[model samples]
Target: MTFDVPDASYYGALITNDSFEILVRKNANTGEGLFLRWPHDSDTRPDLLVQSCLDKEFGVNAQLIEGYDAIVFIKGGSLVNFIVHYLGGDIEAVGLQWVTLKTAWELVFKLEDHEVLLSDSASLGVLDRWIRNRRRKIAEESFDGEQKKWLEKFDRLCDRVRYVLGRDSACYGGDGLYSEYIKSIISSAISTMKEQEDLDLYLNDLFGRTSKPGRSAAREADLIQAIHVSLALSSLDLYNAEYTNHVKECRRVLGFLVALENIYGSSSLEIRRRAIEGGNGRWRGHDKAGRIKSDQIKVGQVKSIESAILKVLEDKKLYRKSDRVDVIAGKIAGAVQGEISTLGLGDFFVDKDLQLFIWHFISENKVARGLIK
Candidate 1:
């Protein structure tokens, strides 16, 4: 089905590049609509909406818009997909974005105005919260489902390759080494992984350091893990805790060897094996494939980031209002900004917007429920 009501949407140019920008008109919905913001109708096709929005916002003789990318960022719905899907064959997505569950909740409460789209105010109360929560949960679960399928495939590969004779595939997760390895990486592999006692022990071991992991550290961790998993899938090194951990963290790696096998068949595995053996001591072959989606912060850049981050944290309190909180947010934002800049994506947002983007990202992606040793 399609949207059944008329709602306002802001339209802008989405440049896809090393440094991309969504050329949005500031105050897009204000009166005397000088900007490219207009109506979205439930039953209308995107081309029609695009044409109408342009005609209404600009003038009778506004030039025909062509050869540009379209970006449809909606509140909490999959309307982006519908628009992208129905926008016809010519349209292409310039980029992808994900928001944290915290940001999702904030948006729902702060900005989601349902009156224009939904007549029932009843649906806007608890129902609205449920809708958003469920949407997020469903997405997470769907990813888990895919992981489960891959996991099963992975277990069988071990059954065939490792020759754990007559061992039930279902029990691979229970193996001591497997559990130790997977739990270290998969995160959600064991639901009730640890309690508070275990976490305190782990934290105490670190001497109560509150400093968050830097983006550079995270990037390096991500890179090493990627290569580790590729090597594991290629059967180069499975006993190493690194590859064992990685094979279970398929989502964070944005699809994995299983996906490749699905598309290219078992030949992909053989190719990967060849790549691994050829690389020898040096990084090469399948091990070198894929990347961390975010830009990496290098060791030399750390000094520069430290001062820059501390400055932001110390000075500003427009909303959160606490130096401590600001510092925390600043660290998160600064790390995010570093990732963006390194990836050549700084043009998408200013400093403040980038901070908010990071806040949302951290919340939506990871949720640590209990402590772990």
Candidate 2:
């Protein structure tokens, strides 16, 4: 099923269970006319056509249609059956419907008059504020619940792994002994801080201490735990006290592990003599240099983590802003600039019209991403 579309033009195909629509537009920058309608409709609505496609399915294929003309496709009748038979499923159909909905929504909202009305209306101010606050609360509660669940699962894993390491002499013998010994030490430390009150005090003390390099590591652990708890609470909104308690307990365990790691290096020299003389004496002189090196690698892999975290925070801020759409558009503009720079196009022509064109494309894409929610 295929149809021929012109070159150097943008085409959007919206296929549904019963009907299909195809729209074709000239250069998105030149304010050219658009042709749109159901394939069978001879009298189509030219005014309803959009300058750019806003569907996620279509936006994802932006590069494919960027400067191309002509699209060939067959819609209706056995076309869908052919699609299902050829593709082996209806996932693409679902995705296409999602894009169609988004495209329709964008067409309604992107009107110049609607933009003016939104900008000039005083009542919209109060409505926007109320919506923002409501959304923030919902996001926070959702996050809390998710955080609690994740923390409980993480704690259970830590406990099980620690127990296995403690009992399995065969697996932890030789060079893996140091990791096992550190695990034991951490497990013991965690046992000592059984209560949340004790754990909180320990974390606060570690946060205040500055004399030891170990304190820096401990402080980082505490900060990371706090951030994790905050994000989880904000994101998950877990109402179960058991889950929250388990998360707190997991934080305690992580703090203990960080402290133990700080005390024990990768060498046998770092292990206490008493530990070597214990029943696990056969595992003495085991090295953990590789484990330490791996941890170093993880710590060094910061760029992607930082970028993702910052993006999340920026998105949250945008959502919280009074003018979320505008703020997001600004972010998208900045993102486009950064992307262009990465492509070595920073020195290219700095045309306002071209920049605006790119910004529109990015903003439409962002809106499409949001609609997936």
Candidate 3:
């Protein structure tokens, strides 16, 4: 029952890494003619096709992680399956440039014309799926190089605070210790303000007096909590909070953490915002705009998803030929919204796509598939 379109189909490779970067070969510098040119042979299985494309394109070995018919192109109504691959650090191949996912998306949207060999859906869907599924992982790894180095510096400062506090354990061993402990530290700073200028400034900052007013309370809470956490890390024998360079170091650390907090929204909100505001303005795993196609859940495979979808159809008696297709699809989509949102598919799946997919699946039993026209 293959349609009379081009006998050619396409297979694409989506190379990604732990650092949230993707490997892609740009068409000149415009990134138009993307996706590896895959030879279609009926005898060739998907895994073999992926491996062949990888070997031919990158001249490197690839371990196939996952594969899916991620999109259907309208040009020839061809279904494109993108194979997701995780490249090892040992890659020495030339031509393939590694770019961050954000850069990759930017390149994708900049295309004014689609390539004959490359389907826009294949490119967009694969990238979108990866981003939605790995948003948190991406954010966590975003702090790898310079950010990690700075964070480690902050950690060392907190460690110093812990060591100083550990020197005086006897006084802080009783109940209501923090109240007395912090007060004693403050009293020491005030009484010796002239002798320990750094300690006095640190104490003033610690007590929230030095900070500018009307800052975000949530962020301020995070800074205060971090200080409390450092203090809580260890309790030793110390007469008072010291006036060493650790004071300035601690202040610097707090400022860095607060800056990170503001940008990342505790490292979660910014990612969510980007996911929503990025390409299509929908957060796939959390929003209703995401889609799930028939290929995403093949018949009789992925029973959890299949059964869930079918149950919705059955509950509304939408399986009957007499039922209206639009009503049936809408009901099914709404009913399975919760399940679909958790399936890690990107937000590209809309109600119209779900309706079409339903009609594609059950039209034989109810109405003719041609009726979709």
Candidate 4:
């Protein structure tokens, strides 16, 4: 049997006036399938794509924010093309309702295999990208207005560091020279931040990320880039924490710390010194007076467990224990159990180790200085 699949399709993200909601639809004919998209065909003119979708779906015009590349999908032995548009405004559309991203994701993605409404690539792609973009937009909104221009300049410095090191700015913690270089940069930045009483003034400089050519100057060049990279990351961490009221932390800085902790273990004196000190406002209020409370345990022991705890502490600075300790332990045990089936050290450790580590971490970090005295 010979059959042809449709050649072209179009979809868009229609954001609400407040930008907190997106227009979505449920097709009653298709078992009430949830869709965060509008339908399009190849015949539509490129110039009128957004307007056409607006006319068909809501009969109201809205601002077009951006257009993404055409995403091609293969279904039923045929190629179907889709163009994604990011739109914003308020509109009343038939068979559609404006829903928060959380509600939309739960309905579209959190479904049984048979109940999946976003089975098509177009819907899934549009929904995924829209959510990600929206979150970033929100994060950016948290930035201080006065620091906005300075923030862009800091971003360029970070970009230059990534370029010179031949590392992707979007990636973190790999097993290579570049990764080591990144670590060094972050370590240096943290170390420098500790001594500066006025963190803002210290960071308000244009430093170099590239080293001068020649073997003699290579070390100096490396040092300079390290400073810039660390400054960029540190800036992000401090600004995000301050502006977002600690509701958010810079993802890159958090990722780097996780990776660094995984490799060095959380208890490593070297790692602790680099991560915990330096007046980085992000690490402020941490109980640095006491040492690691686990006398029975030492650095390099049960690192996977520590890494799990680190994940839970994403909302906090170094050494602080999250309230979700039980949940954290359960997740760690589950991970170790899954790994046990495939040559993991499940027998070498037990749940007690995780419990003990958590206790040690909390005792050292959570206990007040007055109590320690």
Between prediction 2 and prediction 3, the one with superior lDDT is 3
Model 1: how far residue 246 lies from native, Å: 10
TM-score of each: 0.23, 0.21, 0.35, 0.33
Backbone clash pairs in model 3 (N, Cα, C under 3 Å; residues 3+ apart or in different chains), count: 13
Q: Worst 10-residue stretch by lDDT in candidate 3?
A: 166-175
Per-residue lDDT of 1-373 in model 2, one digit per residue for the tens? 1323332122332222211122223221122112121222224221122112232223422111111121222122110000100111233343332222213223322323322222211112222233334434553475465664564555344433333223222222111111223334444444545645676676566445422454333443443343233323322222344555555655554554444334332334323221212213233343434212232323223233223323443445323343333223333444544554564544332322222223223222444335323
Displacement of the residue 129 alpha carbon in candidate 2, Å: 14
What is the per-residue lDDT of model 4 for residues 1-373, given as tens digits with 9 covering 90 to 100? 1122233443444344444455556542354345433446457643355556666666645554444443322222222223224353344436667665445544543333322322332344344454445544665697676556555544454444432332211222221222333445666667677777976665443122122222222333334433444444556455654544221323433333333333323444544432322212122343433333343444554455454444444533222132222222322333434443344434444323333234334323433212222
Poorest 10 consecutive residues by lDDT, candidate 2: 78-87
lDDT of 4: 0.40
Q: Report the C-alpha lDDT of model 3 over 70-131, residue by residue, as the tens digit.
A: 34342434545454556553444455677754455445434454343224423544554554
lDDT of 1 at 40: 47
Model 1 C-alpha lDDT per residue in residues 1-373, reported as the tens digit of each score: 3333223353221111111111222332232111133344568664456555544443222222231121223333212211211121111231123232222222222222322111111111212233333443443464455554444445444332211111111111222122222323333312222433585464343322212232232333333344234324333223232344545443323332232222222233333222222212222322223212223434334333333444443433421231122123323453546654764554545224344333322222222001000
Candidate 1 regions exceeding 4 Å error are: 9-82, 86-148, 151-357, 360-373
| Model 3 misplaced stretches (Cα beyond 4 Å) | 1-8, 28-32, 74-79, 88-93, 114-118, 135-373
Quantify all predictions' global Cα lDDT against the true fold: 0.30, 0.31, 0.44, 0.40
